[model samples]
Target chain A: MWGHVMSDEKKPVRKKLKAASEASRFMANYYHELDAASQKGQPKIAWCTSVGPAEILRALGFLVYFPETHAAMLGATRMSTELIPEANALGYSPDICSYLTADIGAFLRGVTPLSRIYKGIEAIPKPDVLVFNTNQCRDVQDWFAWYGKKFDAPVLGIYTHRNVGKITEAHVASIAKQMQELIEPLEKVSGRSFDLDRLKRVVALSRACSELWRNVLETASAKPSPLTFFDGTTLMGPAVVGRGTREAVDVYKILLAELNDRIKDKEGAIEDERFRIYWDGMPVWGRLRAHSDLFSGLKASVLASTYCNSWIFSALDENDPFNSMARAYTELFIVRSDDEKETYIKKMLELFKVDGVIYHDAKTCPNNTNCRYGMPQRLEQQTGLPSLTINADLNDMRMISDEQTQTNVEAFIEQLEENQT
Target chain B: MKSKPCYAGVDVGASRTKVAILDTSKNLIGHAVKKSGTDFTATADACLILALKMAGKKKSDIKNTVSTGYGRKNVSFARDTKTEIGCHAKGCFLYFPFATTIIDIGGQDNKVIKLDRSGKRTGFKMNRKCAAGTGAFLEEMAMRLDVSLEEMNGLASQSKNMIKLGSFCTVFSATEVLENIRQGKNLPDIVKGVYYSMIKRVLEMDALTEKVVMTGGVVAHNAFMVKMTEEMIGRKILVPDYPQLTGAIGAALYAMQNKP
Candidate 1:
């Protein structure tokens, strides 16, 4: 609800800075696969997780692309799933993963069913280097492998280890060598030097912003506080993409100011949070809105979520990007077991002060699986909080049961109300 | 009399191929299940041939044919192919009509589907790239449990203590099962726990928060259906009367609707 105020005379300049200039800088292109035009004059080459990849590339004055995001967009608009049988018809087969087949179709057809949104997509200049992190899905590795073979583009991949609780010597050495390798192409692409001091300084700025954002989440524990996970979703951009920069600092200052004002005013982000809720694990990208909409329609509010947070406060800490990254990886609820996942779940429940948790075990993810076989029962045994678990790809809706899901949720709430009495 | 219009459906299961045939109104005329071969097309043909013979109809007698399952399109006979999902949704809605959610735990993969009142394919989450909590996993355990695949469920119902199958990955779950056995955990509890573990993976993968209409080869065969429902969802699970045939029925209906 807070708008940036500007002097009347400087309005035009601020508008350009926010929209046009920044849009030009948002040049990061992070597609899992780049099509073959064999064009030489590409802008930048980089990779990132589905969430941070595009934003980081843009920060580097590069264009960002993502195959999964494109796939989800297709699923969202309903054109991609419609073409599944056709793709399978041509030879892909029903056995093939839909993302690959749909992408192959979208590439061959030359126009996505919703092509206008990504105009000049294929024509965007070539990437100087491709950058990626092994954070979400292992399919990313294969996706990039295909891209590397197709374009023979210089690829830089980051390893966000799945099962490891801490970064071992092997993990550090492998990625350290990778980080060393990143130096050459990155320098060659931007024609800029990889200044270690500059990078550290930038990460520090990012850390500051994250701390503030983390505090924003922490403050929500109080009676009527500033923001919710919904508002924080909008605020997640800078911490992810705009980190380690003066602009990052400026943007966060504005956000924290608004939040503090809300705290002083004793108000919540929304007018009336009908049913406070906590979201556990990654936010189902395709279903995020549908999820929120479903809950919102029922006058149920999602006050916080694990996906929107992603342990940002810890990972973005200035103490040593390497050490901090490793420490953050160790704390992830999915990669750990027993005490860790339970401790975090308890913390989230306590911090969000919500009545229940909607856990999203995204299909196709290796690191995320749990709490069945009386596991959720254990949660019931321990925390005495209600738990609702559902299955479906984070975005793929080829098979989802919304009505049944709604029924379960309503019944759970009914039981919760009865229990409280 | 109108020539009996013959219809066919094939299920490309993990270890086996099941085929069914029906007249135009969709009454099952004949059905056959056979071990799947290595080659895709050959397995499909063998299943189709067996099903056609059982229906007492030559391949040429079929006016229209629809194919479903993992191998639907791989079959040379299918005019077109649809995912096991669309066919299942269509098939389940025809039977239950009010079934808004369908959970199919198959041999190779677990598919959780959400259907509308009219049986339109809406949203879904299939399992990861491997078999974690699926029919294949169950069979492997059944072999170790000394219970026939057909009798494992019945034996499971007779057990007293809960064996903990703690691993979520099938590979890990297998090792974990052996470890629990070595630790002297009761067999029924272990089998029940294994089923629950698989159910848990399905829950995380699909985001399932509903009363699920459970169907598939495993649901029909598993005797611990009640315990599985309670453990996986911490609630009750409902299944169709003849759950295993849902996929075949869906395939036939899909074949009939889009016949061109």
Candidate 2:
């Protein structure tokens, strides 16, 4: 009774960015420099959070290392699941941020994914100090504290107000004052005096890189976007790790020009871009390629995302580096209330001309996951666009249900098709 | 005799495989359901043959075929595949033809799909990383109770005092069932509690609209679930004539509608 079935449809091919190699080299160089400094102990190494005060560390002549970046590498290399249980064995709940668990687990196991990429790198650079800003989540503080205790390094952090709707002068002053206090501890750790001129120059470089990154993201607003959120996640390396440096600014410049050229030539990241979707919440670091392929196969382009756009620090002003840095970090989307978040998402949807939104209800990272608070329903009611919530984690592969995700995403695309017709 | 042109739909669920045949008039003329087993392609072919025999038709008579559910892509005879969510929404909408909240409790998963008055899907949600409130849960509970899956529905109907299960996880619920059994609770009451827990789990997945429809293999075998759901929601719940075949029927409808 068996009859012939149709052949499988053609799979969509992803277009590679020409500047990706340059970005990779730049990142590798940054890591190599940190490794060198850690080995020589000439310029002390300071571990900073991804969104922490890296500019100050750079100005103090300390090589800055971001553990979150290392955590992402662990996730992308698909080694997080194996190492995460090590942290759980240390009495850390599996429910906390997977990045934290995976990083600590790797440390406890004395392994690094970076060692495979860069030869002779035994582990992440040893830190003389660890700095963090609690604007993103309290997990960063706790995550840094563990390393601080292990390395016998001083752990310093700037605690910012949560659920912030408006940034008042008082809020900026409070954060700026706290950042100013870090100068003394940072100087002692690095054995270099604080220089305001150098800080201004570093902040200015960071501001230039942020603008270029913002411009690269905005290029997706064009018809048939030149880049996808998956691309943004990779290309934002410099903006996240090498920020406040001339090299970061140069990398973004090369990337922006390449994207602009793609737009000029009417090129798209995917073979077909029939639907534009806005992704909210954290990236499923391990499944980026799979998710990208799934959407590309459905003729959809995830044009914009809150995670990639988090790197845009437009409020950074060189003239008032400390206060502007304070204002910029405080105004982050993750640190904002639901009201502010909703307004920001609505604006992004319009800017990108999105047909739908997909909310990643990441299992481990509640701070980054927004769908639990009825945001998807509220956004749909306001925008009249359909939304789908996929439950997965950034680094925890155990939480993902691949079959369910495929079914839900396919059904969501069908719903969007019906709406369009 | 010249056979009339017909369309077919096959739904290869995790537990069962179903097939439905529809004539040009859109009437479900024939259907069949069987254990999916290991070979989805063979089971699907067997179901289609049985359904076609019932319809008094042959393979050559079917103009188009569509497949749905978990093993949808495994149907070698199907020309296209649709998701279970869309098929369920379409199947329920064909009967009610109005705004509806469709709760489908299948073997391995559950879906809460919302449709507008025009039969367009307004929203949808699926169970995340769990198998509670599904046929698999009921089967596990039945195994724990040392009863057949078919007997639980009838046992639930005969309950005098229904024992409420506190846990929604299937594994935990199974342990709870054992505890109640150990405490000398009646089998009927415990079975009723299992049904209650299943219904409550699906209801909590999403809100019901003015109209609520229940479908899927679990609902097909358990009529008492529909009655209990009505009593819980304080309203009448709609059920298609063959709730188990709605997804397959909906797929058949798509075949008929999109025929070349």
Q: Which stretches of model 2 miss by more than 4 angstroms?
A: none
- The DockQ figures for the candidates are 0.02, 0.68
Which is the leading candidate under TM-score?
2
Summing lDDT over every window of 10 consecutive residues in candidate 2 chain B, give the lowest-scoring window. B251-260
Tens digit of per-residue lDDT, candidate 2, span B138-255 = 9888888999997988999999999999886888898899999899999999999999999989988988976898999999999999999999999999999999999999999888
Clashes of each: 44, 0
Please give the TM-score that candidate 2 achieves against the real structure. 0.99
State each model's CA lDDT, in order: 0.59, 0.92
Clash pairs for candidate 2: none
Docking category of candidate 2? medium
lDDT of 1 by residue, A343-419 (tens): 67677777777777666554444344454444565675577677666654543456455534554454344334434
| DockQ score for model 1 | 0.02
Give the CA lDDT, 0 to 100, for residue B143 in model 2. Answer: 88
Candidate 2 structure quality by residue, lDDT tens digits, A1-421: 3554655788786789999998999988988888888888868988999889999999999888999999998998899999999999998889999999999999999999989888777779999999999877899999999999999999999998889888899989999999999999899988889999999999999999999999999999988999999999988899999889999999988999999999999999888788999999899999999999999999999989999999999999999999999999999999998999999999999999999999999988999999998999899999999999999999989999899999999999999988788
